[model samples]
Target: MNLAAAHPGFLSPTGVEIVFVLVGVVTLAAAVITVTTRKLVHAALWLVVALGGIAVEYLLLTAEFIAWVQVLIYVGSVVVLLLFGLMLTRAPIGDSPDADSGNRPVALAVALASAATLVTVVVDAFRTYWIDLDASVQGSTAVTGESLFRHWVLPFEALSVLLLAALVGAIVLSRKDGPRAAGPGPVRDPDATGPAAPAAPDQPDTDTGPGSGTDAEGRR
Candidate 1:
């Protein structure tokens, strides 16, 4: 019944929208893997993929500065720091038995509740609002910077401090203790000449005393 004519952009999305949906799906899958993986390194790598997808979404939304910031901060710096922390803590390279504590059902329930809450909140907030693709809403660096520093300055600073604290906590947790004693080793006598050099292993009486030795021509 002419749905494209009735709803216009909603029914007939552009190529950007198609790409956005694809990216969003990929991001969601990566996020699920990030949370559910049994290996921490795999989870961190999946987190990078998810964050990279979000950055691509931002770029698709015409926010290049935010996209780059997302890539630089989350994907680059944060993931590298996370990998370093994992290395420093001697985390397992393969599947970590401690990663999943047999609480999958409970965790899944909590995750579903959180997702529902978030979806509800977002839907309620933006149900009646819509942005036109033809609008000239400039998402420039200056505007973004002003908005960040003016209205969200306190939260921004708080986030930075939070990240700093998290980094410090990671370092603290990954720091190793002093070397441990490897138990008592074989004790040697200081006055002994290294156990008499093992008595030369009893070389078959090769030199039959001083005169009984055989010459190079086999003559005694």
Candidate 2:
């Protein structure tokens, strides 16, 4: 039977699930590009894409609250922090300098294994479960606020403190040093033996020593 069209129960759910899958694919693609791309800014941009894709998936999962929070925190704030880091570090706009390291292959292997394990766990847990919605389960904004203040407030405050600390630390780290202490250099007296004296008329005449520069009066 046509459960979606006849009962109108499956339309939103199916559409949401389809969008979730599409966003998930985009997330994976962005994550791969984020890791493999050589440019630091490009990697940060791909990170935004991955993060935004996750936010979209969260919305599709009927978690509008989480989705918006993700958009505000990760896409807006965290990625901006990443950009700030790049700017302070003076990351070159051209190709990344020695971005890839010897352990890249091992990191990729571990990532793939982790992905496989997560997929297995999710599939094993929810393969047969079906989503059923009657009336929407309304989430109260006040409840969310109160819960955030009550339970997770410390971590949230700590995160703000951490970001502020990072900004201060970046400022400290990126500052160029001032001029060094200049040791006492050689001092000279303007008149002290710069040139030889002129010869007396009756005395033996002597020419100036080697490589002498005449003064304004032309005597050396």
lDDT of 1 at 185: 38
Clash count, one per candidate: 0, 0
Which ten-residue region of model 1 has the weakest summed lDDT?
211-220
Query: For candidate 2, lDDT tens digit of each residue in 1-220?
Result: 3333444344345766777788899999999899888899999999999999998877666666788889999999999989876864558787976999989889989988999999999977755556653357433356567777899999989999998998777544433221221234312224323632333233342332221211211221
Q: Compared with the true structure, what per-residue lDDT tens digits does model 1 show for residues 150-177?
A: 9999999999999899867754433221
Task: Estimate TM-scores for all models.
Answer: 0.62, 0.61
- lDDT per model, in order? 0.72, 0.69
Alpha-carbon deviation at 163 in model 1, angstroms: 8.1
Query: Candidate 2 — worst ten consecutive residues by lDDT sum?
Result: 211-220
In terms of TM-score, how similar is model 1 to the real structure? Answer: 0.62
Instruction: Record all residue pairs in model 2 with backbone atoms less than 3 Å apart, i.e. clashing.
Output: none
Q: Which stretches of candidate 2 lie over 4 Å from their true place?
A: 1-13, 133-135, 138-140, 149-220
